[model samples]
Target: MSKRVLLPEDPRWMPFCKRYAGNIERFAIEVVGITPSYQQMELFGSVSPSRSRTSVASGHGTGKTAGIAVIVLWHQLCYPMSVTLLTANDMDQLKATVWKEIGISHERIRRGRHGWIAEHLEILADASCRIKGFEAIWFTESKTANEKTANKMAGRHGEWLLVIADEASTLPDAVLTTLSGALTEQHNRMLLTSQFTRNAGFFYRTQNELSIENGGEWNNLRFSSFDSPFVSDSSLKELWDQYDDDERNVRLLGISPQDSSKHMMNRKVAEAMYRRGRIIKDNENYGWLVLVDIASGEGLRDKSACILARVIGYGDMGPDARRVEMVKVPLLTNKIRSNTFAGYVSDNGAELSNVTYVIDSGGLGINVCQDLEDMNKVVHRVNWGNPCFKNINKDRYLNLRAQAMHQAARAAKDGRLSILTGDYRNQMLDQSARIPKTFTDKGRIRVPPKGATEWDGMGSPDLWDAVCFAFLEDVSYIVSGEIGMGGLVNSAADTALKRTEEMFSDV
Candidate 1:
């Protein structure tokens, strides 16, 4: 500072203040090797005393992180006692990409001049000279950010505060406003940058609303694939050719899909089926189809599901109930092994050996199927990826998995699927929503591998798979009695039982 008595305002530091301090683009270009594109420069220039809100919704490989890392170092080095808070979407992404760039910039700073304060997750700061041997406040914050962590970014105050939020599309509106509160201090700045994947969040609002409204207090920058020279021509071409236009627009050009219908079923239809499912007949005459969904990984990593359903033919039910045609009732759902499954069924009310079991003989299911077969619980062993059965026409569906899901979706669409009211209804709906469909090169309907795509905490639809398993038309029910939670385990043998009256009488 010019007025500081302890610190000297040297000529060497004066030039940096005059030019680079006012311009983050210059500071990034000269100090660190991070070259900013024209779009990046616009975003950097937006942060000032009057106009403080700055956001960039960008595509992949646009050097968004590199641009952000520049301003983080620029704010720390230029202003004494200034605070910089950095965060990203996830822990792995923060460590591997965003923070890694900041680390790079920290290493590039002239070692002698900038007194570094590195403590928080991955933070770097330039400390001012101590006043009367007391340490001057050098503020910097970092976190592997999430919905919870983003909300905790309060109580930080400084002469100048800089908050860099990377991968901010998934960020809730509260985070953006909460982080913006830190910028109330004079000369404070907030840079929000992301690859725009989601269209209905704080990111979407800034790109749409703030960009149009008497737009003086905001800076909105949009970057696409063509804007970045760092990405090669061949790479762009390959990506364009490989992915469909909608996917390429989101992945490469940073555009959110406006039309979500092609990817998923109608929410109202699914919600209706969840709320009101018309049943033809409610008795055990419907027959049973037991589905064994074997999980692979150990501990909480692997998720196993078993769905017991009762199926009734379309013609068997009354007129109103017949609208659903084939009524499938999910009687019991559990995660249990094949060997003990008979006991589990008996405890639930169905005789295990008599019930028809349809084992999913894919992946870890092969061994599970073998274990069940050795116990003689096998009715049908189905490979999920195989072609559709004769009962369900194979032409429209890509595979058995696709066929089952589509049939379930159609039932959901028509509000025809009868699901009994239970605690698992909302969870089932969420898992169903997570199912994203895409078309193969041969025009076949395809769903991406589980855990690859996630939205709103919907990861790996194990429960939805249980529901889908019951949709197989050819699956039969061999049990004579109805399945319900109607029995308790009685482990004692008749020969081992002693009369309690005789023992009490002797006493």
Candidate 2:
């Protein structure tokens, strides 16, 4: 019988042995037959014996899980009996994704005739057993992952130990504390990575606040979908079309979404809330509602526009959501009379009976509202002269215009409103956002008549206010199937508040 020799014949036979242990990307390509793109290689380059801790913030589908799997195998096989602890925000995440990748590496290496595959790795322990989390020959798993898993960082010695915390956003500062103490070993490694979902906490601090460039602890690297060769251009475009600029930037470019200071109805929210299809389905469906902002003056003075919107969804979908949507917007013009406006709305997109009309009762809308009501076309008047707030927040708004606009802004901030993408979309967003507000003598928020002047060609944010009228006035019809007029909504306080809430509801 031939004796089993642990050593290989030549350098070419086992290239992994020739490569440095920290070269994770090389091991992935050479041994596992998996090639990482240039960006992935940069991530591997950041890993080294000298760099004890490394934190990576990455966008979606940048092969983070695959890279993680490669590193685990390389750390365990090359370092020889070194324990690699894997953890995440949740155990399901670890098991379904990171652990699955680990299993894939084990299977790939075994099939590829690599010496690393010669070793057997069975579950040495699990939560079902005496141990709380899973543990194998060169691995440990914990997802309750708080102080209990932090305790595992100690007592193990003999080989270089590596602690890999996946989705480090939720991994407590306690784990870092444990890692700090366990670094007594000369070759210990700690790797933390996650999608940049949060701009606070230890992950944020490690990645942004205290970076290696600033001579801080941990080598930090950020990878976007654009950086990864795995994501194709077509897929990138699809993502861009699907999400708002801020969301797409964060998801595809590894950029922070935004700080707190932004318009209530910013571009980020408009793009995000927008859906592909124009159709509204389900029981919540309300036929198109037309909102008319009457020109403050006749002929080229106050630009008049009518917005057609529908309730695609109803109620507070989340802590931050808007159930209303603007479907179509007609061109702006000067001095559209109530008769012409009524005829324009009925003929533009929706039929007379099938549609609901909410006309701004402020400005020079009294005649327009009276004309639309005379036409017997389900006209609901929105009195902007009333408090900007409604229901619970009535006291906080100077007038209904301010209330409607500010409410719409909150929806934008929370990613609750959706408007179709079009040339008018930009104009509408610009108008909605540009309306400056201030606290009145009575401590009420007031969006004054600033933009409807000669400076901006008397641009009254007509379409924007029309859109607001849809939410403040038309949405009540969607919820209760009723028509209302004057200052207050015709429905109960909860009904009006249900359509939209106060900006500072808690306050």
Candidate 3:
């Protein structure tokens, strides 16, 4: 193998290379001959050796394409044997915007004082950029990001690798994961830029996870079109007049689209909770409950799901201790017989006497609960189709199911609830996201019957049903009261506290 060449060490280029190795902004303005906007400059500053991961969410007219192209050129010119992989949601996007911008920037440098450096660099007909003699070692290449092209992004090892994911929000998770695998070296860097079109994705996670408010420790930049000097005030006014708040959020505010009014749970919130993946531990500050949402029939199409959930207590002082934590507690099988499930409960109940079993009393649930109760287990049977008891959310829900799901959705939105990672994670996320909501004739919040909704042809959302079942307001044992304080409640105090809890639940 031939020895690697270091471009910055050459006496002729040493001063120029040393000046720009740490400052990509100066390199873009002086070397690449382009003026970067304030937002773009901030992005350049944020991409340090220590923090190689930089995510940029920008509105339209922010010149993100130009910013990305300049960075690609900077990496190729300054670093030795560097490989820059440029990718977007589609091949057409590569040809139209960022790839086109790269060609323009390359020409600018080719005609400038640094024209000698651009002489060795070639933008091939195949859309690959490389130094003339060191074609194998130094280059920038474009690949359409998708499941089919994901493999092309992996195993890209080099001394200095820079992966630029343009329009990253539109790329699939598979492509992002593959691209992430390529950045294994310390010198390797990745830049993700996109309009915040959707809320749940790697791009969204980069922004949300690294936020200062979330106690994140990396660089996450947000740039609005209004902040860009190129976007005229008159054009912004036209955008404001043409679109509503949600539309303008994505187009001008550089923010993710807000949760739509239709879906009961936002996919982004659910994904964040899953990413958090905080496991629940048995403690004095929490009361555990077994929540079950059983399949209605004996068909193999539907499965019953059971979750171990907790109501947090006052003793815990941690920042996130106030939220409920849920785990997908196992059953005998996906399609467990009612008798077999009751047996499993009997086996586990001795170890968790303080925990109560709350089972849905619809279809097969009633029979299962009856069996458990006959076996001398205290079971709370909740009829989801029945009207919710009054004083809950000012009678906003049309039925108990709606009330439970609405509360659970609200808890997820408020960051007051978390679902631990498990074997059924993807299923749980899809199910939660597929929850459909409507208003009753009386304008009460209504979650449609499970049969009314379908996601990716999924039959019933067993896991999400268990989650919603866990959030039933009336059934949640108040951990601050006699029930949790001593794990036992005398009849008189129980009656009084139960009434009080009903009157002021979630207040």
Strongest candidate by lDDT: 3
User: Could you tell me which 10 consecutive residues in candidate 3 have the lowest summed lDDT?
Assistant: 313-322
lDDT score of residue 413 within candidate 2: 54
Residue runs of model 1 more than 4 Å from their true location after superposition = 1-11, 48-51, 111-136, 144-152, 212-216, 261-367, 370-507
| Candidate 3 off by > 4 Å | 1-11, 48-51, 210-217, 261-507
Ranking by TM-score: 1, 2, 3
TM-score to native of every candidate shown: 0.53, 0.53, 0.51
lDDT accuracy of residue 157 in candidate 2? 53
lDDT tens readout by residue for model 2, 1-92: 98533323324435555584767776787667777877667767766564377888777678888887777767765655457667665766
lDDT of each: 0.58, 0.61, 0.72
lDDT per residue for candidate 1 within 454-479, as digits (tens), equals: 33334556666766765654555543
Which residue pairs clash in candidate 1? 288-477
lDDT of 3 by residue, 446-493 (tens): 766656642435577777887777666567553422232124433345
By TM-score, the better pick of 1 and 3 is 1
lDDT (Cα, 0-100) at 6 in candidate 1:
28
Output the better candidate (2/3) by TM-score.
2
Using lDDT as the measure, name the better of candidate 2 and candidate 3: 3
